[model samples]
Target: MNLIQGYDPDTLRELVDERECAERLAEIESQRSLPVLLERVWLLKVLDRLDEALELAEETVRQARMAGTRKDLLRARVLHATVLQNRGAHAAAAQELAHCANEAEGRGWFGIAAFAHQHHGRNAYEAHDFDVARESFKRSLFLRREAGADDTELEKALRAIDAAERRSAEAPGVLV
Candidate 1:
């Protein structure tokens, strides 16, 4: 199996240096592979290339919907949600992520389920719906914990929940 198969895209992202990642991802995209396209979109999202990511994610969603596989569909949906979140469309992002979470949970894709919840948490946080943010972050924390996500991510999620709760409880009218 190739390195791409041996390692999850998220982990591989961490391993690759930021400066060179785009080049590597571009090589993968040259193959015109669906999964690779989704991965590239994800990488673009992470790199803050929001518009480009959105374009790829939209295409990924269309293609994955045609495939009719729950896993592929969920992946594309999650990426689309993430790109939407990057673009500040929090409500729609949450809707997309919630759909992905429902499907991934049903299919027992624990990691995808966790990521979906995490994306929802991020959307809620960005929207300043702190109560919902806290709930979503807590839900994501639980799911990510069950998925065996690294302690760093679990701790970060917990911290995010705490922070959101703190932000929510702060005296209103103060610039948070």
Candidate 2:
């Protein structure tokens, strides 16, 4: 098994060598622990290996629920929702994001809540529900700011909010 030594998820480099990361993760995945597996799943997502990520993400969620902490479960769920959204499974993704958002909010995990709201907004945006998307993105930005999240993440959320607002403004008169 290929053990990915020396790569810390919390301190992941600004510009990751994703292919190398993925290769290293894959080398030891079968022998890896849950945390490493989860990181691998995320790396695969970054690599746009959605099918593989989705498969591993599902298993991660199941394993997390079975033996991991609540935070672990939340992470897995967020990953699952991301894969679903990337695959255009908007409704399912929305459901997962809503669950994650509610749970994170209840736990005062504002950063996770912000992430969920951001993805929820993306799901709505994909569905053409501009008004709902706009609201969701606004909520996400507010939560992220309150959480003192990274500036880059805040900027991305702001961009999404702007796009949603633009769409809402341009949408024709039709009952939503």
Candidate 3:
């Protein structure tokens, strides 16, 4: 549980070995490293081991709260919401993301705020709420750009926006 030895969120997302990440993180569970726990949850989700991911996510949120660290708690909440989103629980995910987005904004954590809004957009897109998805993605992109986020994040936001727009155009009852 070396505080200085952890992967960045972007690196975790880009990792080709999800199972390795999960195992490596789990090995440090005794150390109670919040970052490792959160990353493990993300890796589990990527592996489509939703039940394990959800369990770890909930535990991470609880541990983060008990640790009295706002940053860790915010990160845990976002990861938890992502598990819910992956599980197709859109409403719950959206609710969590909304709260997360507001909290991150109030705390001036623009990176987390951007992440929250991006997932919020993903939830909306899954629910076929293209307009809401588009707006959320736009907000996310703005925040990411303002915060000097990496190009990967900006590209992801743009892709979400494009997907929402394409969906909106194809939906019935839309003007041609």
Candidate 4:
């Protein structure tokens, strides 16, 4: 697996034929090729084949751990947990991301911690547990801002959490 230099959707063409992309990347295993496969997985998620995307994401996380240093593990964990959350396995996803948060915190990866928080917030929101979402979203936004991804998904999560809170508060105990 190659290193991810950066995430530029435009340059990488966010959605592409996965098989072709994988083949192309396998042709030349550079320090920048693995991210292309990861990008394919992201595109797969966007296309709604979440199971396949989750599989690819898990593979990406595994390969990234093998190929990357501690510095890169931060990004790998974030991506993997994001895929899990996308699959709507909210509780499991949250637990996995919590592990990522702990690892990032131990490694002084504040940025990763922020993203993990945001993913955890997604998990909570999907589970219809607004209180946890509120707290997680708030932390995610704070950390993303500090990490320079001020306009990232973390911010979007904040918006979603706010909307969820409003809806939940108005419902008056619907009794799940």
Top model by lDDT, which number? 3
Better of 1 and 4 by TM-score: 1
How many steric clashes between backbone atoms does each model show?
0, 1, 0, 0
lDDT of 2 by residue, 1-176 (tens): 32333322221212356668677766767765788778878777767788999999999999999999998899889879888887879889999999999999899998889988887887788788878887888889999998998888787777777777777787888797
Q: Summing lDDT over every window of 10 consecutive residues in candidate 4, give the lowest-scoring window.
A: 4-13
**Candidate 4 Cα errors over 4 Å, as ranges:** 1-32, 148-158, 174-176
Q: Which candidate is the best by TM-score?
A: 3
TM-score of 3: 0.82
lDDT of 1 by residue, 50-131 (tens): 8989988888889888864778888888889888887889888988888888888888788888878877876787787778
lDDT of 4 by residue, 1-176 (tens): 33323322211113445565456545543434566656666556655678887887777777788886775666666777777777767777888888887787677677878777766766676677777877877877777776677564554655755755774585567677
What TM-score does each of the candidates earn?
Answer: 0.78, 0.77, 0.82, 0.70
Candidate 2 clash pair list: 2-27
Indicate the TM-score of model 4.
0.70
lDDT score of model 2? 0.79
**By descending TM-score, how would the candidates be arranged?**
3, 1, 2, 4
Per-prediction RMSD in angstroms?
5.6, 6.5, 5.2, 6.7
Per-residue lDDT over 39-80 for candidate 3, one digit per residue giving the tens place of the 0 to 100 score: 778777877889999999999999999984898898899899
